[model samples]
Every structure is written in C-alpha cells, then in structure tokens.
Target: MIKFFRKIRQNLLSEGKTAKYFKYAMGEIILVVIGILIALQINNWNEEKKYQKQLHIKVHSILGDIREDALQIKALLKDLEKQHSAADHIIPIMESEQKAIVDSLKFILDFNSFTTTPILSQQNNTWDYLSANGILSELEDQELVNLLMNYYNYFDELTINFNNSANPVRLELRELKYELFTNTEHRKFFPTKKPSVPSKAVYESIFNDIRILPLCRYIGSTAAYFEGRFKDVDQKAEKIIYYLETNYQPI
Candidate 1:
C-alpha cells in the first residue's frame, strides 16, 4: 500500500501539473489520516471487549460463591433446629415433672455446648478491583454495585449476630461441666469407684435443678435466631442472582 501511494505521487510530479500535484498530495495525506483513525478505533474496541470478558468471569464467580454460601447456611440452620427440638423436649420434662429426669436435662444441656459453624467470610476482591480500579465507574450505571453491596452487608451482619447469640450457650455448657466433674460424681463414674443410682442421677439432680431448664430455653432461643438469619441469607442470595441475571452475562 505504501509503494502504491509512492508511485502515484511520483507520476503526478513527473507530469508537471503543479496545482494537480498539490491537490493529489493533500488527498493522500487525508487518506493516511483516515487510515490512522480507523486503526485507533479498532484498537479501542478490542480493549473494551477484553474488559467486558473479564467482568463476565468475575460476575460468574461471585454468583457461584453466593449459591454455595446459601446451601451452607441452610444446612447449618437445619442442624441448629434439631438441637433446638431436643432441648425443647427435655426442658418441659425437667420444669414440671420428676426431678430424676434432670439427668436427661444434663444431656440436653450438653447440646448447648455444640458450637455453631461460622458462615463464610466476606469475599470482596472482585468487587474491590472493579470499583477501585475504575472498572465500575466505567459501568453504564450504579445499580449493579448497589445490589452487590447490599447483599454483602447482609451476610456480614448475619455472621456477627449468629456468633454473638451462641456465646451464652457456651458459657452455660462450661459451667455445667465444672459442676459435674468437680464432685463425687466424677470418681463414681470413672476409673476407680463403682457407679450407683444416687451417684449417677440423684446427686446430679442438684446441679440440674440449679442449671438445666433455664439454660436449655436460652439455647433454644439462640438456635431459633440462627434459623431466622439463615432465611435472611437465602433471600439475599436470591436477590444477588436476580440482579446478575438481569444485568450481567456469564463467561
């Protein structure tokens, strides 16, 4: 192409048409400018396409993380619900019925000691890049960023509250363990002494009377709170999915 343009310019100059040569020379300069402009446009288009591809991959990854966290939260909710049910059964029995039933309540109190598995921590690396690197600024609107921020904040709050509520149950369980093992009951049930009904159930009733029923109800409340938060997390995940489907594409 360069050779062709050079040949045309040489022929026009050889013809001694100075005015015509000036016009042709100007035309050639215009064509070269146009060509440069087209090349620059193509380069910008390719850069934009590459960025969109990366954005799609990041959005898909975030969607997958949301789905996995939703399932995990649901499973944990069910386990806590089961623990709550068992405690409910033993609490009423200890409250109004036989004092010997307190041994069963002690077993129920042990349920309170079962720690809740913590929820997944916040993962915002993709979000940070898109926002901090000005990728999000390049987005046509703010809707996508707003939606993600809302869901992220929701799960972060859920994890904090869930752990806070579970703390009392742990304290109750620790105290119960101390009462049971620090007395004659430990020796009677373990390596040396023979076990008897009084050592196993009757005397243990004192500790049970002091602690069991109240602690079980407190544990139930904590478990129920966790179940409610699990539902909230699920709702937030659904919201995120809805936004992704409406405004973003998968890679």
Candidate 2:
C-alpha cells in the first residue's frame, strides 16, 4: 500500500501540473490521516474488549467470594444462635428456685457457652486484590462497587466491635469461670472429658454470684447483635451476587 501511494505521488510530481500535484498531495495526506485515525479507533476498541473480558473474570471471582462469605456468615449465625439459646436457658434457670435441681450436665453446658466466641471470617481476598491494584475504579457499575464496599465495610465494623467491646465481655465471663467454678466443673466445659456431675453446691455458687447474670446478659446481647449483622451481610452479598450474575457479560 505504501509503495502504491509512493508511485502515485511520483507520477503527480513528474507531470509538473503544479496546482493539480498540490491538490493530489493534500488529498493523499488527508487519506493517510484518515487511515491512521481508523487504525487508532480499532486499537482502542480491542483494548476496551480486552479490559471488559478481564473485568468480567474478576467480577465472577468476586461473586464466588461473596457466596463463600455468605456461607461463612450463615455458619457463624448458627453458632451465635446456640450461644444465645444457652444464655436464655442459663438466665431463666438461675432466676428459678429449681436452679439446683436443673440437670448438672445441661447447666454446665450452658455455662460453658460463654467460653465460645463466634468470630466473622470474611472471604475478601479478591476484594483486597482489586483494591490494591486500583481495578475497582475500572468497574463501570458504580452501584455494584458501592454494594461491595458496603459489604466489606460491614465486616470491618463487626470485627472492630467484637475486638473492642464484645470480646472483652466474653473474656471477663471466662475469667469469672476460673474464679467461681471448681476443676471438675471446668472439665465439663470440654466434651471429650467425662467429668463427674457438678455438685448442687456448684450450681448454688454460680447462681448466687452477682457477676454471672449480668455477664450472661452481655454475652447474649453481643451474640444477638452479631447474628443480626451477619444476616445483613449475607443479604447484601446475595444482592451483589444477583446483580453481577444478571448484568455482567464478558466480551
């Protein structure tokens, strides 16, 4: 093509039709500029297609991560519900005159509930990768980006609250166990060890302690709060997943 254009230009110059040559030269320059622009536009289109393909892959990965996060949140919610149930049972039993008559094994199990702390384990590896590489900005759907940000931010807040507030209450309850319960009673907390049934006196001591009831209430409240937050996060993840699956198609 270059050789063809060069031959045309040489012929125009040799003919010495000066005005016609200038016009022809200008037309050739215009055609070359048009061709360069067309090539550049094609290149831009290819680059855009490549970027969208990569973005779709990343979005698919994010959807998987969110689905896994939802599962983790579901499991954590179940554990929290158990803890809450334990608290409810222990509180009523302690308040009742039949506290001593309550099954020793059941009472010990409920008492041991405070020792278990449910922590949120978020599946955010892909999110972190996108953020670190500044690829989040490349996402065209700002709404989806916002949803993702909110979902991950909720996890951050949950972690902060657990560490700063809920965890301390749980730790205090655990320490109280050491001060209030005998070694035999403590061993009941572990299911593998078949400890002797705790004495009525042990139940009496636990029930009579001023610290136990309030601490149990605190633990119960924390569990309930975490359960609610986990549910919200699960719902948000579902929404984001649905949006990505429905709207995004790779080039």
State in Å the error of residue 178, model 1.
6.0
Taking all chains together, each candidate's TM-score versus the true structure is 0.73, 0.84
Model 1 worst lDDT run, 10 consecutive residues: 189-198
lDDT against the true structure, per candidate, is 0.66, 0.80
Residue lDDT tens for model 1, 107-214: 533343343343455555676666577776666547766877777777777777766767556566556655655456544433343443333453455345667556
Question: Against the hidden true structure, what lDDT does model 2 obtain?
Answer: 0.80
Which tens-of-lDDT digit does each residue in 1-251 have in candidate 2?
Answer: 88997787788788877788788889988998999999999999999998889888888888888888878778777878888888877777777776644567776777777777666666788899999999999988899999989988887787677778887888888787788877766665565565556676677778889988888888888888877877887788889988888887543
Worst 10 residues of 2 by lDDT: 188-197
| TM-score (C-alpha, index-matched) for candidate 1 | 0.73
